[model samples]
Target: MLIRVLFAVLVVVSLVLGYVGLAEYLATSAQYAHRPLDLLYYDLQLFVINSAPVSNGGPYPWPLEVSRFLTPAVTAYAVVEAARLLFASEIARLRARRRARHIIVCGDSLAARTLASHLDAEHRVVRVESARSPAPLIAAGLPRAARLYACADETAANIATVLAASQVERKVHAPLEIHAHVSDPELGDALRDRGWREGLEVDFFSLDGVAAKQVIAAEQPDGERLVVIGLSAFGRALLLELARRRTEPVEVTVVDPDGEAVVAELAARHPFFAVACHVSVVPVYQPEPGVHLVFVCHDDEERALRDGLNAAATVDATRGTVIVRMAELAGVGEMMVQHGQEDRLRFVGVLDMASVYLSERITDSLARAVHRRYVRAQRALGQDVRSNPSLVDWDDLPDTLRDANRASAGDIERKLELVGCRLVPSLEAAAFTFEPEEVERLAVAEHERWVAERRADGWRYGSRRDNERKLHPDLRPWSDLGEAERQKDRNVVLALPEILADAGYRIVRR
Candidate 1:
């Protein structure tokens, strides 16, 4: 707005100066008398083409030359500035579209801002302020977006954003990945369930889950003695994940004012925690020697920071790593970076963790789905696949194969959900039922997914004799498939409903 006003002022000043300066030059020096209207007309012409000869047909007066030079310069400046102002937004939209993969983040919340900051360093990010509607996403170029993050302050706003983005994705068939932020893990799980039912690409992320993963992943093998000084959502999540990931039996002392009741509730919620680790709850912090990790995760940022600092002071600097969770982490992070670097203190922020939680929703889920299919396919081949499909290192998969598998998994999931056999969590939790025909339709979808995965692994169509017994050469549609081949696809689809249940999911009607 300021730029437009400045350009307008420049243009007006130029016009006035051109007319007055040239008119005075004509009257005094050239002795060429003319009407004020005539002088104004001449000045307008001069402004359009400053180098054009003066109509006086005499040596150009000094003032006329000055007017000539100043007029066109300002005129050109105004014209260019006007054009830029008119098309600036369009040009920016075009630039964003040209980026092969870009993310659209909607909302002005801390999570949205943090995500944009993290992503902007590498990927093109278009941020929109509208949290209540999806219109901002469409206006921000949703058709070209590879991912959309809806991280609003309110859960309802985030849900609304997902609905809006889903509508855009359905209309364009653009395969846009949408991520919605939810603080509660159960709510996030329910949203994922709803996503499968809606046949839309949406996932929910929790910052507490992200922080739990981060802290657990940082632990060394020998480090088992840990002190967790809160029973907040994040603290409980950390303890559960720690127990789940621990190979050997471990002990975790939980210091919470809520006492044994909170610990008992958490253990019951996650049965694995009870079987894998010993959790002792105490009323207050007790500094124990050889404590490997100390986590001060409180809802209040100041209290968490103070508790973390106190815990850090008690622990041996060379032996323990202190992890602090703060709603706002800027001051603590900088303070630790400056003074507490030697103490091995780690800081986690509720809002900034959204970047980690939301960034991998699409890719990570795709990878997991591919791994599940791989295990199912291998079992069908009569190979002795392990009880735990994720036992094998997914990171060791070839880049080409992983990419292909993820793409194929995404396509398969979409198609399966479009039909009635959408995935859900357990039989009792199923929101809808899959009909016999819908289950049969999934066989055809699975067959295509198989073919695509095989092709991705470098298999190609060819005659058996020419190909010398190459795999997946006789790829055919479900109708053309013989009973044996059809059975293979059907076997995978038939196993899905129960397999999903065992894997903490089920297949429900779309």
Candidate 2:
């Protein structure tokens, strides 16, 4: 009511001023020279008040005359407000560019909100564009994203824009990989296809869907590494089990939250051959049984493995016991039969078979599905036919290199016998290379390392425990040193390797 009355007063004042102006204009300047100009600006301002220009234009400077003709004083104040609002909006655009979070999302609003909610835990989100506010997305846990703009609506285009916004926001330091959520299966597939096109990997699975078979299959022969990603616990355990039982290697990268522990443990236990700059290459599985030895070398393959890419260099002085380092293995249980004597080969690895089945959801069938898919892709490429260069090309190397390579090759073929991993044509190198003596040496070295590490760990723990004991005089018993007990577990590290070495298997380094 107060605003309405003030508005009426402004109108009366404007009308009175107009009447005076009209008389003055008629008396002096013919019909007021500025009337036509002011009227044009007023009409344009009235029509385009909400339709603001990117560069210029705003509401009236003489708003009193244009609005209600309240008074010249009122008109001056209105003009100031219009100018201030216009500049303020421009500033908003600049600030948003600097600070806004950009999230590229797909699916219906609900799905977007769901995905947004998940992403919002760690990031701010920009709602691309829509009539309604993205409050649902914000509610779902997504950060507030007020400045929404898009160059295009296509998936690829949207990704580009999101990247742009990310750069503008300087998100590269604290990186956030794009998270896509598509509710519809068909749309999900489409999005995935586009993701690959954009050089991104996408993992997907229904919470309920399950595969049934578990056997690893033969491949067509593309020599490229086959990687299985986004595996569930069941899949990871299955894969790890297959690798454990195999004689060769299979590359696996599990992206499930539950599976990370398995991967970490595997990493800790596995013998790693190469610690290159960016690639922390660790072979996931080795076809050989009773041997998980990773050899580190300054140059040339360690004595256990011949040298270079020459598979021959991989042979151990002790013929039956084989060591594979920096290797991944698959298809071992059945392959073990080909080796002829189970007692001949000793299998040892950083692998814990229990880890394979640790995940409740992991199943043999999913593992087979992942492996079979790779085999199918390879077969489609016609990589088989002895042309699988991983075998022949390395096999065809000059005899000087090929001898050690041949020995290495024998080691691998022999390895298949150990684990029954037959599909992998013996690669002679890490396949069957490892000297038990060298492995023992590696193990001994490892034991020393464990001893040192454990000692250090013991000291660290002892200090803490002793400090606590000092704090509580009553609980501190003569031998009631819990810290000392904790330190004892450090010796557990060297125990396993020693037991394996004592078993008479060669424990070679990669």
Candidate 3:
């Protein structure tokens, strides 16, 4: 009789527990169901407990004595029912996202992964075809393109997958962006011929005749660093010249405020940029020559840059120190000439807005032209070169800065905001703690490389003789090349080392 009673109790407990779970499951999908159980230690109660004690026991707790028969079947039914209700929509949601918008990437490289992760998740993506993956760089940036040209991967097979999966004809985006070789030189082009407008973006994956110039150094060496600060919008072009002309570097730092990332990235995996780049806050104080370049943003920024540099730089006239100021920047280039002559330092003014505006690669070619002109102009000038003022007295900097600020102390940030000079803060570092030597050397090496390569190629110098005359120390050695040259190269990438001469920065080269 005791055994029979225990068995009956067990049956009653199962019926009650199963009923409760079903009620909770029914009201909402099991995905949405949650609540507290009756007991403290037993709050989790996966199974039911018999609350009735010895006082007056009920034979069975369930409404029907036959509920025991259905207990075993209830467990399986409730579990599956809850899971289906909970996850059915979730599965459908993912599939829908994949419908027309999803992009299936195929490379297993680190760069590919990083680019994918940083992109917006809503931009559906999948790595469906990566086995012995063909190059996929061309297709990677399409989803980010500003204009039209996106792949038309309807419900059929994915354009990325088909091209990568050996079913090349099925790839809707005609030109498959293969990070590696596409194997067939004609394949990328053939797809376009066959009505698919797919083509290489040229920043990356354009193996043949890609205008391949934006290299890092001569011999096109790898891993050299470049930090360029252009005073105008032309800085963007300067970056392209460096990358295409030099060899790949470990890393290149481009100080540009535009959206040049696509160009920077595809050409070299190691390229970095200092966004919103501007000239130094102070004038190139005691502008010297060598690896460092101190440039003012405009004629207005000139005094600010000059005052800042003069205040910060050291000066020594006996050593022939000179700080060159570029007045051609705006209409105020004569500021360098006036300061140089008054200070009795080596000061020479150039009619050279063109040289200042040349792209790094293009300017690299201007050396022969520069050398020839300076040589010719020097002989014709009856005045002495020694009379040039190369160094700006360090003691004079405080007053100079204060005075320049008084005249026009505005920075480049406010002016170019419309042309998207928002990246100025990159140059306007809150705490500029870098040792000048390292950054200077890096910039000079890059400039020399850029200049040297152009010299080798033999570029055209428009007015070599005319520039030589104005570059001379007789006050205006290269006056003819002014402002016209300003629109040529953007700004001087090579800062004057302590080699400031009266010819703007002659003393700095020492």
Candidate 4:
């Protein structure tokens, strides 16, 4: 931008200098009689190296001589810049194709653009205008890309790009991590559960889900009473995320016109809804007393803001917060602050939150480390691919399992808090350890956390372990677990320091 500005200034200055010099030359010299407009026109011609003002000149003015060289140089620079602008994308695409381990973002959608913008400068990002065909993906360097994000506006387009990328992955005999943006929660769930091509690891995510995760992380909304207004996709995602994070059942009231249908849909999709939350549905928007957090998730930004404001007015300022879902924060957020409701009224932008969380989740070092540790542990136990399906590499692991690992990684901070320790950034190698009693306590906590997670995922205790039926023998109480099962939890607890260290963090007793 600064270069363009300088170039523009140079062009204007050159043109002005040329006009003044030509005017002065014509005024003093007896060569030609021309008007000011004609002088200006002739001065403009100098830029293109066109007709010179002087036919038979004895001497030229200093300004005229300067303009004579400056105009043409500026013209040449303009031409070169134009050419560069025209071919920059193509050049970048070609270079990206030759580069190995680069990230390819295949889409021009908001999510894709946002993700591309948020990506770290360390990783080379190649963006395709659209993902309607495999040609663009290949052109964007899909074959050599370490990761591909198919974030087209249409879910179908993202799926098509994923399939194309998978075929390329198979042909090249190289691994690729593909993340597809599926807006519909049910479709995202179904696609994830159905699984994808073997050699290529595929994951599906929704804007709402990402936004919900961001909101929970930022707000830490763990109140006893929660109210969700407007049963939009974001609302559903928020409920699910809340359920996943909460260790105990929380009272939740969902206010929407189609409350019954929404409740039924949630129950059908997630059996763990009943286990993690005590929920009630109400058609009318009522300000429930003692509500800790209220999420206004209307699809319409204006409606969401209006409801959020109303909730903010009634809810206790000290105890409650109203979070409104917004497409962007510019107009609505300022209005809230102006109205002095900034403290209690918060807004979450879908694209902003989604882009941030999506990038972090996809390239999460801690989550990758967690998966690697799990794989190592499984291998140490002599478990092969046939014996354990999750005994594969991080890229080859299914999305569900990957999410579980990510969830476990996400809980490390909370686990650290339980042991009176906190994670702090560290550049050097971390060699921290927990006390023996602390490790045992954390192990118990980890086991209980795992059991809750399993139950919330619709798993049930059974005599035999069955993945197909969502049954596991170790789903019983921590006391009922054999020493082997208990040891696994203890191992994870002990490995906390190493895991945190790998992710550039070290545990420090608080």
Stretches off by above 4 angstroms in model 2 are 1-13, 16-70, 100-126, 130-172, 183-510
Model 4, position 331: C-alpha lDDT score: 60
Best lDDT among the predictions, by candidate number: 4
Which ten contiguous residues of candidate 1 have the minimum total lDDT? 424-433
Residue 407 lDDT in model 2?
35
**Tens-digit per-residue lDDT, 97-159, candidate 1:** 554346788888877888898887767789887746556666677765667888877778888
lDDT: worst 10-residue window of model 2:
206-215
Query: How does each model score on lDDT?
Result: 0.68, 0.32, 0.31, 0.79
Write one digit per residue (lDDT tens) for candidate 2, span 375-480: 3445777876365423332212333333432332233223323333332211112213333443334333333443444344332333343532332222232245
The residue-level lDDT of candidate 4 at 139 comes to: 77
> Candidate 4, TM-score vs. the true structure?
0.67
TM-score of 3: 0.23
Kindly list the per-residue Cα lDDT of model 4 for residues 1-510, writing each as its tens digit: 998899999988898888888887888656666798888888888889884574445377888878988999999998998999999988977886676666788887877887898885656788776766677777777776667888888888898887777666422333466788887765776787666665566778888877887787677666558889988889988888887777888888889878778787787778887678788888877776687888999888878878887888888767888888887553667576778756788888888777776677555767987886777778998998999888876645766898898889888889889878898755345578789899888999898888889999999999998889999998998889899999888999998877765554678998
Candidate 2 RMSD to the real structure: 27.2
Ranking by lDDT: 4, 1, 2, 3
Top candidate when judged by TM-score against the true structure: 4
Ranking 1 against 4 by lDDT, winner? 4
Q: How many residue-pair clashes does candidate 3 contain?
A: 101
Give the TM-scores of the predictions, in the order they appear: 0.61, 0.24, 0.23, 0.67
